[model samples]
Target: MAKQTPMMQQYLEIKAQYEDAFLFFRLGDFYELFFEDAKKAAHELEITLTSRGGTHDRIPMCGVPYHSVDQYIQQLIEKGYKIAICEQVEDPKEAKGVVKREVVKLITPGTVMEANLLNDKENNYLATVADFEDGSFGFGRTDLSTGESAVTLIEGDLNDVIYELASISAKEVVVSEAFASKYEDTLEQQLNLTVSVEEERELPESMEGLCSELEQSKLIETMAPLFHYLIKTQKRSLDHLQKVTYYSRNEYLKIDYHSKRNLELTETIREKKKQGSLYSILDKTETSMGARLLKKWLEQPLVDRKKITERHSVVQSLLDNFFIREELKDKLKEVYDLERLAGKVAYGNVNARELVMLRRSLHQAPSIRIM
Candidate 1:
């Protein structure tokens, strides 16, 4: 073995922190990957697999231009890989040694909020489950794209936990390092989820007020870790996230993964297309918000007859008033996807075009209100 270069040594130090992710070290206009990451990325991305340094001292390396990195990231994400974006923290012209670098962001499938990388029709959720001291278990789930968060406390067997997870269809699952092994096989083989094991911490005393408000003191054990993880990874205030909506399985009609597929409620059983699904038949929705809300209602039908009747009555009125119904639909067609737009704004990723779209979307509110 030969001595490593100063730049390589610095890269190694940062790489150790995110061993599971591909580190994209920013170098001028490109983000470079070295050693094993370079090899893997080159093979997967089918980019030029080259080397750095002189002959015997050479190391495998690959990179994409900074402007085009998103396309490369999308490819890696589709292939189920997490990316740690390492950036130049200092100016190269001023630095005496190798310019300082640090991981600015970590991109995972569930956490990606870019419109191009996400499906507008579906939610991408990251979930967490932890067993409490009592027989009960606490579950936490969130969709970063929609700024939605929910928590539930369930007391049952491991199968019961699995059942709840199946219904939500979370893309990623987080658990304490010690508890990871217990459900690793079940999560991988059965649910096809990517599991991430993180260190656990005692429930924070600061969250006491929030827990009291939600009447979910028990969720402190399981749910707090998810909030902690998001804060750490995002490194920003998630102002769009609503209060944790505390719910239970009994709150909605229970539907398992197999039953959802069998019934073709949201998607067709054969090709998984929406054209022949129940959703397609009933979907006269003009806005993305309406479409998503309709899907949620279908998936979690209310068991309460009064609530069901109320919804039916509303629909009946809309159906009976032909001109008003058409007016409402016309106005709704002018509305954009406000939920996702709000999410982007909360995440501090909204641009001028999106802001214009949001403004236009809101302008339709008056006409909708008139209906």
Candidate 2:
């Protein structure tokens, strides 16, 4: 017989729903994992690998304490893992038989909104793509913490959205229920984006002829499952995405991938990002994760600008010039949150850390006052 704990049963139920992402089964003091997730996290995070005493051998198990979750989260995130934090919604002592555990948060390299898990000048983004209107679809997204919104209308090109999303690497999708099947199939075929669900009653439904056309999009059969990040952005894309071309006021920072590595945007200015201290002003109060992510993105923009810019000339004069790149890469998991940080800074919700990072990056190239 399969040994069953109330907790295990609950876990299985949630896992069935969130099949694509790792479930952090929250117990009293630790965030637990079961089966394959347990084995993977145990090996990767160096946690104590244990097991559930089941009749047929045993079920895999592993976990990290709530206190040290931040560090462990960093390791998993760095390895491109997505963790769904399932926590006890009520005190076990006051609960019936088993405690109520719910997914308090889903942590992906992108869309992180926690403190102690984020940095300054960084942004975390989650985007939604949809197929709508006569074989044509649109894409839309918003950085909740930074108020950065995006709407791009893609025409007749499903893969175009996928390619664009891949270029930007949107971390999650608020999918529509109607086109779930085709969206899943297409995303798998075209972009290799996995799927997951968040029961947000707030997600908008798609209208128009998008339903049938998208459900009928051609499917390809020979692509490999390209697993980059653990938390899935979409099983398929959700309903219809918003307009696809306009840039949000506070959008994901862009410098082209080339600029992020060799050239340092913050070489001209160097300051550490701290929370609630002198750096508090720049701390993304809306979401610190975005702040930290933005900081790194600014240091290492993803672009192909000229090698010798005036700002590069200034940064090249420093001794700890390499810190610019180090900090950038060290914080590269989800620079999506850069938009949130930008918004905060733009609205004067920041400090020296924000100013320094922005000044250095802006110095390198031409002024970027988006219309």
TM-score of each: 0.92, 0.51
Please report the candidate that would top TM-score against the real structure.
1
Error of 2 at 245 (Å): 9.7
Model 2 Cα shift for residue 218 (angstroms): 20
In order, candidate lDDTs are 0.83, 0.52
Could you tell me the lDDT of residue 163 within candidate 1? 78
lDDT of 1 by residue, 1-371 (tens): 67788998899999999998899999999999999999999999999989999967689999999999999999988766789999999989999988999898888876777898987777788899888777788888988888777888888878878877777767777788767888787786788777777675555454444445466567666767877677667765577776677877786898767788999998899997889999999987887778878888998889888889999999999989999998888777778889899989988889999999899999998777766
* Model 2 global lDDT (CA atoms, 0 to 1): 0.52
In candidate 2, what are the lDDT values of residues 243-360, reduced to their tens digit? 2235321233444434432343332223322332333444333334545555544443434355335447655653356765454444443233344445545434446765665565
lDDT of 2 at 213: 25
Off by over 4 Å in 1: 202-212
User: Judged by lDDT against the true structure, how good is candidate 1?
Assistant: 0.83
Reference-based TM-score, model 1: 0.92
